[model samples]
Target: MLDTTGANPFALSYNKLMDVALLLRKYLPHMVSFGMFARVTDITPKTVEELKNLHHLKLDSINIGIETAHDPTLERMSKGYYAFDILEQLSKLDEAGIRYNVFYLNGLGGKGNGVASAIATADVFNQLHPCIINIVSLTIFPESQLYQEVINGTYVEEPEIERLMEMRTLIDRLNIRVNLLGHHVSNTVPITGALPDDKAAILREFDKAITKFPEKELKAYRSRIWHL
Candidate 1:
């Protein structure tokens, strides 16, 4: 989220990396796997290649928060990249044979814009091709910029059901071969399944979730269900 341009100026030198690599090899002879949460903007092909060279710490996967593909939503959340920059960097990771997971924040777009945000995000996912896509609903804690926005009446938090609809929209719009895991502490409903293979099933599950609330009380339920 810090990097909008996908560039890292402060990378560890290859010799310094080799020093750490030697220590890992000497201490853990049997260690064969490693993973990391990385900023998609900072991961270049060279970074992937460097990780691949380290035999003891086999970097196989990375986790990144793509937030939302909609630029305004990203701007709203302080996530620094746009859809094109994200796609380009993820493409680099793919070309370097690095598998990765993406995290999407539901309700980040605020109120009624969830559907638009989900559609835009799904459009990018189709091209970016993450191994897994995870979801988390927004929770505005105190002292953050988002919280400040809420204080100033600049942002209206979406209701829980609306957030679920946003998640469903993202699930419905995806046309890629990726695992969709919508389990998070903040999520109202847990939506977990594989894409393409479980698309229809997930849709059914979403429909059930939507219909669970009686249509008559859904509007009022917003104030009753989850605290903003």
Candidate 2:
């Protein structure tokens, strides 16, 4: 898979998957492992078994978008799966010995729901246990449904610092042993480390971020640099 596909390759038919695997075996003889972007809702027991077979052919580190674990937020964000569905699918992935990284978008639940979003997300992470968790705040795209929602006053975005606070709450609530990565275009302060081991240190880093960047300035900075 040498393509940037928005589609879940696993959602394709068995024959299609076999064609892909055969193509890779023919062309990339030395590459033992590869990765792809997949949605959390697309996994089933059959998909997990196919993924396990793909793992035998050296497919690794699939990136899944959990985005938010709050059911309302997931629905508003247009994610096809709810928290329980995500947990169930990830559990299947674990049973299949397939490794994956999960991406969580901050500010998905907006201002009043930040803490709730964080707590729910942390709850899912505690159960699912992915290899890595990538955190980044939401950014608006003019053509997307989110931008329309924001413009029409349906989605109220939280302040950038409020999003950071939610991120802090997530860090604090994390009870697992996975790596966390927050160095992205949307992260105000880049935080990289593992949980339960560097928990205190990560909290200190978040405190420093809080002190270094005030809410007002962060709001302006993020808006100024906003892109599609």
Candidate 3:
């Protein structure tokens, strides 16, 4: 069967899911394997079970943006769900036999908290199973609320070097076997490979970048990009 998906499939209500099933049957019968993104708060045990039972829909995979498992950083970013909520919801997905990929946003904990955030995130991830861990660095734009927080002195952005260090720490600490993707435009270094096997090489790359790349050079690269 061909894989078919949408930007945020779980955002659909029960009736909308039924509508989609009917449309798929009528227009794209071969498109049975489904995958999409969802927020941690949007995932519920009931919804996961329902998806599992809906054999025709075949929603088998999902992507969740679990930026940082550190409670303070999660709260600071105004993520509606906490670390416990993430574990609770993802456990439901596991029970329902659904696979998921998660995002680990670098520099989420601000200036001095990068390493702490990395450690906290690694702790949470060790207990779970995700096919992929996608990494992206935080890039605050002028129109974003985070930018306002930066202006008011309530939030501080992590430096590029610190972000690289945080990324290295995360790679070093992760114990699970999964693909680590850092190809997002916001990242200073594009890294992608399977974990444990490629862990040492990934760490070495980060170490090289940290030692050789000047702060102004990295900051300049960040400034040139307008979107992530």
Best by lDDT: 3
TM-score of model 2 vs. true structure: 0.90
Candidate 2 residue lDDT tens string, 1-228: 333346577666646666777788788887667667777755753566776787777666578888989998888767778999989988877877878899999998887888899999999889876999999788777878878988999888887777878899999999889999998877777789988898899899888888788888887767776572
Q: Which candidate wins on TM-score?
A: 3
Each candidate structure's count of clashing pairs: 0, 0, 0
Better of 2 and 3 by TM-score: 3
lDDT of candidate 1 at residue 185, scale 0 to 100 = 56
Sorted by lDDT (best first), the order is: 3, 2, 1
1 versus 2: better TM-score goes to: 2
Model 1 worst lDDT run, 10 consecutive residues: 1-10
Q: What is the Cα-based lDDT of residue 166 in candidate 3?
A: 92
Residue 60, candidate 3: Cα error in Å is 1.4
Model 2, C-alpha of 57: deviation from truth (Å): 1.6
For all predicted structures, in order, the TM-scores are: 0.80, 0.90, 0.92
